[model samples]
Target: METTLHHLHRPLGSTGLNVSPLGLGTVKLGRDQGVKYPNGFRIPDDSQARQLLALARGLGINLIDTAPAYGVSEQRLGPLLQGQRDHWVVVSKVGEEFIDGRSHFDFSPAHTRLSVERSLKRLKTDRIELVLVHSDGRDLEILQHSGVYEALAELKREGKILGYGLSGKTVEGGLLALEHGDCAMVTYNLNEQAERPVLDYAQAHGKGILVKKALASGHVCLKSDEDPVRLSFELLFGHPGVGAAIVGTINPQHLSDNVRTAAAVLSQQQ
Candidate 1:
């Protein structure tokens, strides 16, 4: 007989970090102009954002993800997370900036440093727990020539970031990120599995793995009586290398449902 094990949270690779099975993404809390949700939504005000964060904590989510490409998400989080900073694992990204309703990329060493500094200021933190290179899909080129990876590693050495990884769009990029950094964020959903190799490498190497679009960004369609959300977690958490699935939602009810589904899958996993 095999001994069953239980875990309330999953480890982020070998980074010596553990996060809730569900990570709260703050994009919807700030940006709504170019979002791809099923329906339009009003950007939540500060009070509403705070309430969502509180609800997330109560539901056992410990990871919080935001990005500079997310319009005002970093700025909004700085003030809202004032006294509760120590209790969460915050993940932010560099290499992309959203301005004037558009996005632009810069991964030069100078810009990487500047970006991290700006992120620190905007997030009201001296150090970020994890930072990932916001990739531009040129996996091979970015991994080989971008110099952003080395810059982030230097920041980690200098204690500005605890760890750095790649939020990449290609398997090669994800593998290179794991080889050089601490983790890799991939899009693994019921509808897609192209990045399975990256997750396999993480599992083999004891490195971190974060899922970006576990539910296919709400593109999942149910057949018969299948629950897409539940199935997403069943496939996502079923993989031991997956640290957490980052889901961006401002609706409190939807957030609750996500957490509930993740918890159910984790229980089943044990």
Candidate 2:
């Protein structure tokens, strides 16, 4: 399918960051935790991954989201975008640690600071466009923690991070972060409409809303005749507050199909 790139540029809240409506999720590109479903998805080599990244750029996808906990995702993505780094907006998360092949949450101020520095080295970027606190299901306590927020604010001052946000599963967790953070990547799929209230709040506050798992983590099985995948992308793109949507895929053809589907959906909406 011939893809038009215009459908990819979407406003990222009030931050003035123009990003693709469909973003590349790097969770699976890093490690396989045997979590099932999307978990255990193949991890692409640097060459193939870079080719995909370049394809995203060609299709006008400028926002790339990753987390330090995503195994070697940052390590792979950082160097891959070395030449075209400035052309894209890179986002990463903190508050999670990987030790002895295990993932753990540490939202303390010390850990937050350490995480940012480590992510910078891994991403090979002097300053990240956006940094989010990878909430480990502790939204309330983490928001109240002076150290974590203060550390992020400090990073903003030092120019290491342009802004910070939060990523969580629950609406309450996301709302709590928005009380102190600038952006949010939340799960707001068609089947899970409980997050509409949070989405409205974020829109009112001029905060960016990046939707994750827009396909309901593959729960909404697509129909062979109706193209359920395209419909899902349409639903996500039609959401008024959603600034971006992250869809995980390693197949080049699938990625191109996503871009094509997004173009057709957005065109219909417009």
TM-score of each: 0.95, 0.92
- Superposed by TM-score, candidate 2 places the C-alpha of residue 27 at a distance from the truth, in angstroms, of 1.7
lDDT of 1 by residue, 67-158 (tens): 99998999999999899999789999999888888889999989999999999999899999999999888877877897998899899999
Q: What lDDT does candidate 2 reach at residue 77?
A: 83
| CA error at residue 58 for candidate 2, angstroms | 1.2
Question: Which stretches in model 2 have alpha-carbon errors above 4 Å?
Answer: 38-40, 222-225
Q: What does candidate 2's lDDT look like per residue over 137-220, in tens digits?
A: 777677776467788989988999988888876778788777677788888766777777778888788888888888776666
Against the reference, the lDDT scores of all candidates come to 0.87, 0.80
Q: In angstroms, how far off is 224's CA in candidate 2?
A: 7.5
> What's the C-alpha lDDT at position 31 in model 2?
73
